[model samples]
Target: MNPNPLKILVLYYSQHGGTQNLARQIARGIESVAGCEAVLRTVPKVSAVCEAVESDIPAAGAPYCSAEDLKTCAALALGSPTRFGNMAAAMKYFLDGTVAQWLGGELIGKPATVFTSAGSLHGGQESTLLTMMLPLLHHGMIISGVPFSEAALGQTRSGGTPYGASHMAGAEGRPELSSHEQQTAFAQGRRLAELAVKLAV
Candidate 1:
């Protein structure tokens, strides 16, 4: 193993665990690349109520993402559950808070990718992935998508898109990913990591 591996941040927001599952698979793919590491982090839920606040640390699952994580990561894999064809408020909120990073070019030239999960097959998975890319674009990060070269992208009937990795969670919000969805997500992550490695050199 390399003495210092490149860190790929897998940041996500999941309400019912579906998005989180996809994030985990993507992380697995990132780790498959030698001299690369996947750093999984999550954002807390947001609420309309002004007084609502999450504890400094989460009760379970990945810890809340920190600005330090963003600064140190060599690459990024962003994920969120579909919310009205867009990213969930929590993920959006987190991204919105990164103006400091954007202005300072903390993410400039870094490779990034997106993933999402949606209820129903037509639940706007692609739109969510695209919307998630907008912030990274503004940050000057190199965005990537799942290319057709990945067989699972062409074969997935449930969830998989050229925009990025995705999953059809069904109306009940199941977190289990189908074989194709898993493969596509893995391919996406591996591709992003490879790009980051090359870019770093």
Candidate 2:
């Protein structure tokens, strides 16, 4: 491993904080590995009206992500709350701006993963994870998913998938992560970090 610590970017857009909870767990997993650090970031909500604007700094939670962050990360863990079976507009907007990174091949060989939260068990959790992976794929990132060997993947009745970590927030939109979901997120993050470290080596 390199002397300098690897930076794993944990980026997400969360409306009700469920996705944010997942992000934290993933970060924890990344940090569990030596010589790896997790950089947590979030995107601002988009306004339909062109005239609307948001403050540069978020009022709470993570700060907005920068293109430089994406360019420099050793690995990425992307997340979002499912929006009609897809990733939310805020995350899409942030990713759309990464064309410059794509052109530069800044992320070409980096490992990447995805996660999501939804309102129900059958909600678009998996679909949202897939859609989130599209941009990473375009950036030529090596995608990694949670494997079935993780105990949570096979046992979680809530929200665990081979695609990535997820949460079933139910109708009330709770932010608390279930134990199984937490383990799944940690496992995904650890896997991503481990892959990144090996690739960096």
In model 1, the clashing pairs are none
Model 1 clash tally?
0
Residues 1-201, model 2: lDDT tens digits: 757789999999999989999999999999999999999999988977621768888999998999888888999999999999999998898898888898999999999999999999999999999888988998999999999999988899999999999999999999999999999999999999999999998
- What is the lDDT for 1 in model 1? 83
Residue 32 lDDT, candidate 1, scale 0-100: 98
lDDT of 1: 0.93
The Cα RMSD in angstroms, rounded to one decimal, for candidate 1 relative to the true structure is: 1.1
Q: Write the per-residue lDDT of candidate 1 for residues 48-88, one digit (tens) a residue.
A: 76227668888999999999999999999999999999999
* Best by the TM-score measure: 1
TM-score of each: 0.97, 0.96
Q: Runs in model 2 with CA error above 4 Å?
A: 1-3, 49-51
Candidate 1: worst-modelled 10 consecutive residues by lDDT: 45-54
